[model samples]
Target: MNQNKRFCLALDLKDDPALIKKYKEYHWSGQAWPEITDSIKSAGISDMQIYCTGNRLFMIMEVDETFDPKKKAEMDVNNPKVQEWERLMDQFQIPLPWAEDGQKWVPMDKIFQLA
Candidate 1:
């Protein structure tokens, strides 16, 4: 594996199967909007992968040493295309019951890692 830092996050898909299918479709390689990919790259995110099972979704992000979540969040706020993509995605996503207000992807605690 690469030396980049990895963060894992979890969220839920709206319990509707159809919406979940559409969400998967939107994530297909060529289906994602170019602006969305560009924004992520510009934010210093080296790589990102999302997986789904039932109604649960997991995201694994690999970020470079220069990546700052706070800075990325601020940049995303000022990017209109990023906002539009987020709004579209919100239709298929739901925060976990324990998630704080305004939180979407809840960070996961890493319990163990082998050296």
Candidate 2:
């Protein structure tokens, strides 16, 4: 990644225990995670990491300036494999009340970072 690149995203989770359990099962079972991971890579992101604590899921990705969030979002929507993966995941997702319509995962704005 270029030194100037920046990437980060945050996804608020559903407090429902059932939803959390279901998400864990799908991710650890390897039924759909590999494809989803690969799709992100195919889109030109790097050094991605996912973290969950309590009801928040945070993802830090390394992406160059050329990366366009809208384009990436469209790629995810256009890919059948990605679409299916998302469909499987919809059951576990809960939209945040503060988010705009149809937004599930909300991006975090960077406030400060150390080099």
For 1-115, candidate 1 gives per-residue lDDT tens digits of 5668999999999999999999999999879999999999999899999999999999999999889999999999999999999999999999999999999999999999898
lDDT of 2 by residue, 1-115 (tens): 3453656777766788778877777766355567787887777776576677777787788875556778889999888988898887777777766878988777789888798
Among residues 3 or more apart in sequence or in different chains, the pairs in candidate 2 whose N, CA or C atoms overlap within 3 Å are none
lDDT of candidates 1 onward, in order: 0.95, 0.75
TM-score of each: 0.95, 0.79
- For model 2, what is the error of residue 81's alpha carbon versus the real structure, in angstroms, after optimal superposition? 1.3
- Reference-based lDDT, residue 77, model 1: 97
Q: Model 2, stretches more than 4 Å misplaced?
A: 28-32
Best by lDDT: 1
Model 1 is weakest, by summed lDDT over 10 consecutive residues, at 1-10
Q: After superposition, how far is residue 95 of candidate 2 from its true place, in Å?
A: 1.7
Tell me the deviation in Å of residue 70 in model 1.
0.4
